[model samples]
Target: MSYKIIVDGIQHKFSSAHFIVGHDKCGRLHGHNFHVAVEFGGPLDPRYNFVVDFIDVKNAIKAEVDKLDHRILIPTASKDLVLKESKDNLDFTFSGKRYSVPRDDVCLLPLPAVTSELLAKHFHDVLSQRFKGFKIKVRIGETSSTFAEYGE
Candidate 1:
């Protein structure tokens, strides 16, 4: 039989800013204190009696969170958006609006939008690749009551 290990709480979170292109209101940049929950499913090891070590799972999730914390997430694949990078800054033009920031302050994702659904899928893909032999589910909280989940 297979077992599941889940992780969630205040520590499994990050704060970041993003905007959904083409959305009427969400197209405007905003920030969220986003939370993440990860579920790992597989047969438990007979010797360890656990699906996986909790500390290892937590560290893996935290590593992804650390990359997004306190940064502005940009969708690198958006056709409506243009990004120009210089030695120290990144310039963005979206829907006729322009924004510039230090290159170090942005996280460019290979996605078309920076919505919670896509973020969940992104994390799911990242974790699934890093940790094999288990089914992975990633839930991204856009707010305390709202979230998106992806699994594979």
Candidate 2:
């Protein structure tokens, strides 16, 4: 009566680290060949005898990450973040510092950092809002050896 789905993707690679305020530890700048994974669960369709179609799941994931990939991910909390969107390029700012990373190099994420764990939870939370009666899991791997997942 229940089913699951997973959506995954990978980043071209970038180097950066960030942490929320009230924290003393510094997250150094680093790059990760990130891999993303996602899972969804719901009632099985009587006709198909399966949960949501795999194609639907995959398509949804692709649509989401199309907004990311090959971009400098930044935080909204940074006072220096200056975002300028136009027909030509996307601009960002932080601490009076401006980074004119090519529009192609900026991935505007709904999440805070590029970490796999945060990405996992961010994916889970977004899909959960769209699902009517289902559970989902999202896993993002920073490397072949390091990955993070979120669900239930």
Candidate 3:
């Protein structure tokens, strides 16, 4: 039989700043109190009788989201952004504007954009690596009403 377990709540959330490229309203720097929810699916282990340990899943998701908490997310793979890195700071130009932020306050991501859809996929990829052999679904919410989901 197939089994599924979901993990979500106030703890699985992060607040970060990002901007969407080429858009009107979202093109400017904005922040979100982003929330994450994950679903794990597969046959239960014969010995444990559970899909996986709840503590393990929570810690893994928490670790990933904590990296972005209270930081500015920078997408390194964007062709429209010009990034210059220094020992203590990061300077980037996007949408004809320039910004210099402290290095400690930035979370560099290997993504083309920092949209909710890509963010969900990014979490899904990390969870997939940590929890192999199980189907994984990652859902990200920029707000209580808006969300994006990604998985196999």
User: Which candidate gets the maximum lDDT versus the true structure?
Assistant: 3
lDDT tens per residue, model 1, 1-152: 78899898568888999998778898898999999998999998889999999998899889999999999999998889999999999999988889999999999999988989999999999888888899999999989999899996
**Model 1, residue pairs in steric clash:** none
- How do the candidates rank by TM-score, highest first? 3, 1, 2
Alpha carbon lDDT at 54, candidate 3: 91
Which pairs clash inside model 3?
none
Per-candidate TM-scores read 0.96, 0.68, 0.98
lDDT tens per residue, model 3, 1-152: 79999997567999999998889999899999999999999999889999999999999999999999999999999999999999999999988899999999999999999999999999999999998999999899999999999995
Q: Sort by lDDT, best first: what order? A: 3, 1, 2
TM-score of 3: 0.98
* Candidate 3 segments exceeding 4 Å error: none
- Model 1, global lDDT: 0.91
Comparing 2 with 3 on lDDT, the higher-scoring candidate is 3
Best by TM-score: 3
Model 1 CA deviation exceeding 4 Å by range:
none
* TM-score between candidate 2 and the true structure: 0.68
True lDDT of residue 75, candidate 3: 92
